[model samples]
Target: MSKFNRPDARAAVSSPVKTKSRASGRTYEGAPGHARDAKSELFLLAVANMVSEDTFYERAKDRDDRFTSLIHKLAVEDADWTARLLGWLRNGAHMRSASLVGAAEYVKARLNAAGTRERRTHEAGEGPGAAAFGGDSLAYRTTTNRRVIDSVLQRADEPGEMLAYWTSKYGRNIPKPVKRGVADAVGRLYTERNLLKYDTDSKGFRFGDVVDLVHPVAGSHSEAWREWQGELFRYALDRRHNRGTVPNPDLLPMLAYNLAFLESAGENPECLLDTDALKRAGLTWENALSLAGSKVDKKALWEAMIPSMGYMALLRNLRNFDQAGVSDEVAEQVAARLADPEQVEKSRQFPFRFLAAYNAAPSLRWSWALEKALNASLSNVPTLPGRTLILVDRSGSMFGAISQRSGLNRADSAAIFGTALAIRAASADLVEFGTSHRPVRFSAGSSVLSTLKEFTSMGGTNTAEAVRANYRRHDRVVIVTDEQAWSGYHGADPLGQVPANVPVYTWNLAGHQYGHGPSGESQRHTFGGLTDAAFRMIPLLEVGQNATWPF
Candidate 1:
């Protein structure tokens, strides 16, 4: 067979994104750029976007404005598509703020469109308020808006959060669709345990506030259950206003126990609650520690909290556990939970979170457990059949914090993912690049967390040079970056040097508007998210299948 005509050489091309477009913009660093269609752009941006948080090249307000604009446009253009995206953004992608913001904007835009249509019909002298009050079109739109809003408000606290975002941004005027959607969510989400866990004074819109505004009835349940829910709602209102005497111990056991605990703890700050007592009272670690005050024994408190703490809480407090000198026995129990695959999956933790925990944890005891958890979380990162080149962008711009409150930045996130890919692949060469490129050394079964230490922040994004210098005859290429690559000396695209027959996957960490190379078709593709879920598309594309939207 001719060299170019061999089975490997003549690999088939697959289109991941079907949209048609040409390179139409410049990257932040002046590389030739490709523009994605509205849907593609929004998908990439929404998955990676930490709402109201600044990126290296984009301001917080500007990024947020762009996100809202895209959502508003898409919400009006294709309501069903936009609704699915919003739903998946929250439930599937685990983006809380973005989904809430998107749902709010989605309903607002659709409502505005309905209002415009009604005005136009009224002006045409069709009938007075006929389009607004009696049209099937309006009804359909309302149903869609309500469903989208309900879809995003999955957490018990989210209905209140949605209302808070809406009132803060759009004002006190809560539309019927928004109210009905929130009401639907409240019925499903509200419970005694949820009230105890989430109805805190820190939130602007509390459970009581949501119940008052939306007036949600009990969800599908027996008459007795519905009556109990009514009592729960009333108790929530009374508790919020500091006028509640006591919740019924039989119906709202958790709330009743928590209230009793708070009163007892307030009366006697020095009295140390036993682990079983704390567990029964459903005291969160924060409240437990606060209540303990100067009499607090860190080790005793942490041990008590460990059993009741959720997986995420346990993962985050490893450093605290170590600092508190938690016993080896207690540490083993924590490690067991951390290393449990079931627990990791149930937590819905982002892969980068394990990295954060690993970095924060001071004790080496957690290293192996964290490694196991990290690998489990990255189950979506496929093991390719042949050699792979993994490029991690360590550019200056990639160092911006993912969220204002988070210490983990895009640089760390990229490194974690790139390293995980390198470690998991059958045969892989990992490279870190910015102004220059070099192979990152790792033997077989290298630790992803350990390999992260070798990466440093380089000055600029010389992506084209990196790919040109490092493109061996590998089966595929995976570049983890913000896509803000500068033009090479000859102004070449970053992936231009690689042959089109060999697939190139861009794992975008920062969702800049313009990509460094053309993607969404052929062997070249782009995907973005804090999770490794997007990596699942590579195997599908390699097998000559089109990779559709994740949702």
Candidate 2:
């Protein structure tokens, strides 16, 4: 039997008997299986740190047949374990975890009683009367709103029932995005269940319900915008019920309205949008061209549409319009904008945005634009006052997809963040570690995309050697990885070699419960997420201040 009472925890180090067997150096239950036990510990470490609940369950189920019972026991009696699991599910969305609904349902099913759930300590925040929903405060409402919506969606079977669940559980705290998601989900469900006939009469699908659900705050930027959107949704539903055809571009949400109008106009909707109507509908020039149907003057429209898109949005969507009427002049203009260092400095997008673009673009034609974006992204990276060293793990496990849908692996994500940090730091050295440590160099005028393409992924996970070899006099050390390092030559203890005065922060791409590297939970820390906000915490930690979750 294992020494620890908890079935899910790591195996204990001590042997059941102090005496060693003659046949083998160590014996357990009269067997020579200590090596196997060591392997199992490594496996457990990997399972514990999976990105989220769904991933944890997937890996556990694949690794052990008895995992169902083990998870049930953990859910029912292990409060700390349950909270940690829930935290992974709740917060992992920004990091690209599977559905929150699925995670909640899994937890609820294994609870002591049916439909019974409780909030955990870290999520509830420490204070008197910090209830799960936290009454009417906006901050508290946002904290629990996403969770409540996912839970309600999982529980309710019908749109009407979903509306009732929303009314009772969410009350006034319902988020606008939650409303849109629910409407779309329920619409699909209704079609599958032959319940679409009941939609017209329901308030949830019509104007009144949409308004009530998304009553935007009085002075917010989108208050008037949301009101106009509500009008369009109402009009569409009303016209659908009455078998009407015309779709007004000024009142409708761009995509759906554009499609409907195109259909009504024999797939040849008018080339021009009513300027007043577009303004009233909060439409962008890009919105007007989204349904241009491939027949419009691509160059003239592109030039005229110059003022319609934001710099970031323009950069993001440039490749999408490559086949359209993009003239050489237009491409040149865009390239010039990209090369402006000032434009790069002003862009709010994180380094990963540029990396993603660099990864997806097809040819040298887009290289200049991508290079500029990379430079701009690096400008946003905060400068560290002291020396910093960054280690990015390129082990095999880091090649797993960041999200099932993103098509981006954890290795690229690590490289993107790691390289950006290195470029931005006033004084820093960057390296990649897999079988062993190696310095990652960027050639002069090299873009993040090009650097990543040329960077080779090594096979083994000699993480300890990487850190130990790179441990110079750096004041701060940042290691980016999935944290699945195997037993290295130096015994998997990279953090142990660092001097006491230096701070080591591990950014866990996969939300695994255990770290192959060390984290002190204080000055030395580990954070999990896809956002650049995690970088903001380093300066705070350097100044000896406690940093709260960036969300």
Candidate 3:
């Protein structure tokens, strides 16, 4: 085969985002930029956006307003598509606050549309309410709104969380669609264990509050199950008022046991429950520690609580474990779970979380385990054949925290993901760019965390110059950036230096309204998220398949 005609030499052409020609815009840094269609813009922003959290270039309210506006537009234009995006945002992309906020706006827009239709029909003398609105289409919209609301409420606490958002944002006039959707979710999510774990005083909307508002009935289930749920709901309500009575031991023995233990523990602060007793009572670490008070040894308490700790709880408390002087044996157990592939998958934690934990931990003991966990979390990142050019943006605008509480920033996220891709690829060139650019050298099998230490905060985003400087004859180019490229002497495009034939992937970490380059076209693609799942699109595109929205 001729060198140019070879299969590997040909550029992989695919459309990862389906939108029209990009329009002209400007970056937050005042660079000439390209604007994406509403759907494309919303998808990119929703994935990385922590609703109400500010980026370096955008304030919290501004970003949140943009997000809500896009969702509101799309929610009415294409309800099915919008619904799918909201569901995936919560479950697949693992964006919690954004999904919750999106779901609320989605329903609000749909309901407003429905209301408008009803008003028009009544004004035309069609009838009243459902009759005036035309029942079939109205029912469909209602069902869709309800499903979208329920889809995002995956966790037990999310029902209450969604309620809080809806009430706070849209106010006390909670629509039936929101209430019914929450009720459906409550039926599925509410459980004795969840009540014990999340039904606490700290949350504004407790389990009892949700039940009171939604009045959820146990959906179609066995009679025994319904009876048990009824008792559970009533108990939740009572618990909020400090008048909860223990359930019949036969129907809810576990809850009864836990409730009895809590009551007894309240009476005797110095009582130390054994591990077996704690497990049997289903006592969470927080409850256990609170019940044991200051009398119990920290190390002993953590050791006993380790067995019952969820994956996230364990990951968060690794520092606490080290501080408490947990024994090496207990540490090994925690490490085993942390590194377990099944446990990691079930945790549904973002890859950045492992990085955050790794950074926060004080001991070297957790270094190896965290490394493995990080790798496991990024299992979707492909090991591409041939050479690849990876650019990570470490500009000033990339320094904002991903969430208000997160210590990690978009820069750290870009480096972590870009480094991981480089380390995993067969042959790669890793570079970090800001005002200037330089190659980040790392030997094969180097730790992602260790290689990250070599990267520093570069002053500005000279994306065009960086790509021009680093564009060798590579098979593909992946730039992990906020896409806030600085306008060169004449506002040069970042990926313009690379030939249009070769594939260029823009991993947008900031979800800015404007992009550094045109996307949704052949050989130019854009993806955004805090997870490695989007990396799977590369291999798909390489094999002559069009990558569609991940739902």
Candidate 4:
């Protein structure tokens, strides 16, 4: 019934049918509808040229390190070298209809088969000899050992981690004494550099690798961030400083940390950051105190810095200081001192080390409390303003995974968040249509949060359903998709089903900007890089604020 057979793809166009239907001007079963949607097909053809995976990779390979990392992750997680190469070898091999999930599954099956074969070969003693090479037996194994070492070294960031990785990966290749000595040497080197604090003489450093999965996470920058935080905490509220009249100037870094986080969240507090503009604005503690008329002028800067009571209190807690231990009077004094905006430098909210601050701020954590608030306050999020329902792709591929910080989950989160915003923007009640047509499958209407967590990172993407769901309503339908449209051809969409007045905005979320303006005479905003799904939320936020629905 479709244009092509399974596992094969047609070039997405057809020669005009020779015959015409007597009942209609043209009909190849659905040719009349298909002819009507041909223009959309033609537009997509040009778009496919501009932003396909191949095009994106070619553009990003050398130019962006982030993309390189993404490719590297792809290589590691779901590689299918044999099948992909076979696809290339065969003329009509690849299909956009095939989900990457299938490819991943194919690769997994091949790996299992290969493992089984290798074991069988070992049992039969038929695949080469114990040594892979006949001429140089010992050298061949030694070369394999060296390659394993190289692989471990390249991935491990720390000497300890490097040593551990080596021991784990090549324990049998390396003699026990050699492994122990290597780990000890690595730890000693790290300690000398102040990168590590423990004594190397400590035992149990030689870890046997049974696939060190958690080690990578433990040894990454995330780990360093944790250790650095603990050290900095001690340095900040180190109570011994109370012995002197002067607070250690070293504490400035602590405030800087908090300020940096707030800034990253788009909350820029002007006080702490010492920008040239601030200096020119007469925002200095001296000038601010002059305005407030305070005797705390001599210690003006110190007094003002102390009043960020929330900031200071959090820091005190992080430093292991018990609130109950601090006398009520001293605590009250500190709180009162920082209470006055004049004393606290209302401008001091500047972000200095925002990432560290955000990481450390347990108050802003994603917990049950925050989730409840998110559900309540952000409920009634508007749709793309005109659609009865907006179906979002929650498949793992939908996530924009940049730095693991912009996990494609945001695409899901953005959809939910955007839904809430849409509800807020709309004056009418949101008549919910709870049905999600997964490519090749469909499901009932569900909560955005559930979709966020359970959506497969792999699946056929059903862009047609996503775009065409709201044809009957006056509501606008918007689809921000990578435009690759991985779901197999569903024929020309039923666009004619919708009222002509209904607006449909297909944001071909390729990794480049095609510019924005209404194409169907409705506003369209196309971006280049967001196809990765990292900043999907950003567009929703921007749109919500301006209601930049091109129509």
Candidate 5:
């Protein structure tokens, strides 16, 4: 008989245990359909937010490729869906992992299995672009060029056509991250066996062809270089020499080989001395600042590189400019350069950095520098027209790290976002909720770090009671939570306990598979993501309008 029909030895030895029945009137029943639906919601969350390995997708059985299956159907059936999925890969570094690339491959395999006319082909160097359908079909501005290159490298069947796209279609002015990825791919040509296994050396030759087309030499060029490996460097050197500028600054290091070659051949070093390529080499922000003091103009170097640095880099090296012979006036100019409100909106880590700085260094000598940057970054927060109640969940589960490598926890991230919103809103009341509800006092113009110290993790989640304690004459309620509550607080659903007229909106900071969120499958009053984009939904949600796609 089958295992399901047989009585196992372990079953005979074990005592029977009773399981608690779920409360009545709830939609979730732990049924197959329920779990399937939950997985579907998780797949959407993974696409809209960042993908996590511990979530529903990882727990799925080996045969169940529901998520990948859906991704293929969406790619073939709708171009807009394809654009959104591709666009989302640009959300963060976590989104650009190998798992996402594997998903793209699965989509291609499914298309092939169906024997459809839209089969992916590498003919004439056009397999990956086929996946995108066409250049005009999607908006290039929505994503970073580096993400596009990473996606292309992951999906392309051949390197030659991919190289052609970079030269002919993608353009030479690529971003640093994208250039790093491409350079790594090119550098691995001799070492990586699978990169260039084709019969003809046409791809490398084509790349060299493009280089000569762009920057022709007077004398005959040597054919000493092999396929693809040295051609990219050659192209970069030629281009840098032709334009008197380094196209991609990160690729600037490859010019070292050219410098040696030119030196041995009795060429002048003045050609590269005029270019700013050396200043952009892979180096720490502090090291780069120090090096730029002698070789390049300090003001120009600071202006070009400071905006690209992450919040942590900017925070950690606040004193570097001063020590690097940069005048106080120039340092202030660099600080103001990064403090632009428009640029702050594009950064994902400003809130976290601002909070970390606020908490770790309340009396830091350069605290004012970070505060000015933080205020400028938060200048875009729309002022609410009425009283707003902001509830921050500080449960034990939230103390777990958001990423495996990150020291920051979800609670702190929530606090950063919460404190910013509370401080920015026109009229607001801020409270921390865990096992019990309590009001938090954050004085006007007070430091966010000091305010964060006032909040701590309680043992259990009492969301309903917490909401009731703080729901005093407020127009709308915004709860920042993981959405996993214990039993109902005082025997009532959190939403049901609230005043009927007051709409409850849950901002799901953690992308849980099955949320305790009231809206359930119909996301009429729910949103997800770890950024300020969620706040934009509030204005539209108040008028009974659907939330726009935040990413």
Candidate 6:
């Protein structure tokens, strides 16, 4: 009398048209266990649940509290079996939308049914670290249960394709929380589906706090703030110890904070100045900032203060350093100087080293260096096909570089070069595949300009598919996704499409778009509709011409 009623409308319609026979060698029951394929998966989950539950102690005499609690937690967190069961009931698995909400019901019911345990109360006579159980058989039971759970959680960190395959195969029906946890995963993926752009977004700005440096380092303090911050810290430390000497020309920002301070410190003796900074020492940003710590300089709250190393100096004690040699006396002197309301206001507010040093440094070399470093890194980033079917993630996260074309986002421009290298001189077959589909070939001497002619970048990420398609063609498989897959390339679910021993050369795609893919962690982010993989990283300017992370 259930929905399985025989004379249903669907059956009536199908009466005229005979359905395909569930065939000979491949029966519905013949599906492989653990495979993303549905029939097989449902059978497997049911069997597993039945077996695990049977093995678990449930007899009245064997009713162990610790074992019961552990089993309860497993029933709560182990939603995988439930998700797969529900998924098998609906989709056969491998359906694109299956990852979203397929396996929700059965898992929810089981979790709710899991019983609770009594809370423990520590005995007054017991020591701080004493066990709640009186060192009896209960103690071992509790300890073992905790240890087992820890081990399970730890191993889940790199769940990778298996979890995604299983979840994606049946994730949709799994309810919201499990759905999110499975999708979110414990990873750094660049898929940008979560980000919502604000209307007429404000130009890049600092975070709400001034000291947190959420904003871009620009303007007033832009030129020499970093140097000033350093000069200040060192000078303060030195002055407290009574050694107010500037060490090197590199550390010369201390002399540059003010023409007056420079003259007073005898920095460049030829220059004349009217200031008492020399005798008292031109306080470094290090000197002033160490006094106030991480707090904002209240008196000059309106102004943007730059520490000696720009903002780096102010972020002290945030990093661990061995400064045991320095005396408490130095800290006390800095505190006393910082106590004066006027000096506190002046020192923290208008620390001069940054602007002065920036003005003095060689023609925007720092800016130039950053740009060049990125450019230089990408310069030798070998072309995709030339290397192998390095499935580069061309998702939403890739949108920015394609649109903005700046910073480390120039990889967009490098795509053409990849084809050129592979098709032109490579000894192997140069096959090109994007997103989750097939490969488009470009023969050597073919048009590099339009190699991406048929490449319409869209759709969700499919790392597994790209790898499987080219599994046999080459020695290595280069994956270029942002690794933001809630679900991944469909093969047979847990099979994960990727061939073992075939090292996937993961090249993370980053861009201006925030969440289309793994945003920054290269090989871990992605972008675009997943179509037209929108962006790329290109640091046109950097000091080191030859450097890149190990693939």
Q: Which candidate should be chosen as best, given lDDT against the real structure? A: 3
Residue lDDT tens for model 2, 1-551: 65666523321122111111112221111212112122222223222232222341136444332333334444344423433444443342222122232233234333322222233434546443435434433333332333333333431233344444445643645444455445544433322112212334534544335434543222223776555545544554555467554545554445344454445434443434333333333345544576554655665555555544556766666665475557777777777776677776565444566666655655466687777667665543577876788999887777766445455677787888787787667777889988877888874344567667645687666667888899898877899876656555545355657765567787766644345543433235665555455677677666656665342
Best by TM-score: 1
> Can you rank all candidates by lDDT, best first?
3, 1, 2, 5, 4, 6
- Model 1, span 1-551: residue lDDT tens: 48566776544555444334467888888877888888878988899898988899999899889899999899888878889999999888889999999999998887787778777877877865544455446435588888889999888999998998999988999998999999999989998878877998899998989989998987468888888898888988888888946999987787788777788878875444477778777777888887888776778878877888889899889999998999999999999999999999889888888888988994789999999999998889888889999999999999998888778898898988898888878999899999988888887778888888888878899998888888889999999999998887488868879987888899888777888777777678888899988989998888877788888
| Residues forming the 10-long window of minimal summed lDDT in candidate 1 | 10-19
Q: Candidate 5: where is the Cα deviation over 4 Å? A: 1-44, 47-79, 88-106, 109-312, 319-334, 345-350, 357-365, 375-380, 444-449, 520-524
Q: Clashes in each model (backbone N, CA, C under 3 Å)?
A: 0, 6, 0, 43, 1, 94
* Candidate 6 global lDDT: 0.30
Q: Which regions of candidate 3 deviate over 4 angstroms?
A: 1-12, 18-23, 124-140, 266-273
Better of 3 and 5 by lDDT: 3
Against the unseen true structure, what C-alpha lDDT does each candidate score?
0.85, 0.51, 0.86, 0.31, 0.49, 0.30
Question: What are the per-residue Cα lDDT tens digits for candidate 3 across 413-474?
Answer: 89989999999899999999999989998977899989999998899989989888888999
Top-down TM-score ranking? 1, 3, 5, 2, 4, 6
Q: Which clashing pairs does model 1 show?
A: none
State candidate 1's TM-score.
0.95
TM-score: model 6 vs. ground truth: 0.26
The residue pairs found clashing in candidate 5 are 358-449
In lDDT terms, how accurate is model 4? 0.31
TM-score of 2: 0.58
TM-score of each: 0.95, 0.58, 0.94, 0.30, 0.59, 0.26
Cα-lDDT of candidate 3: 0.86
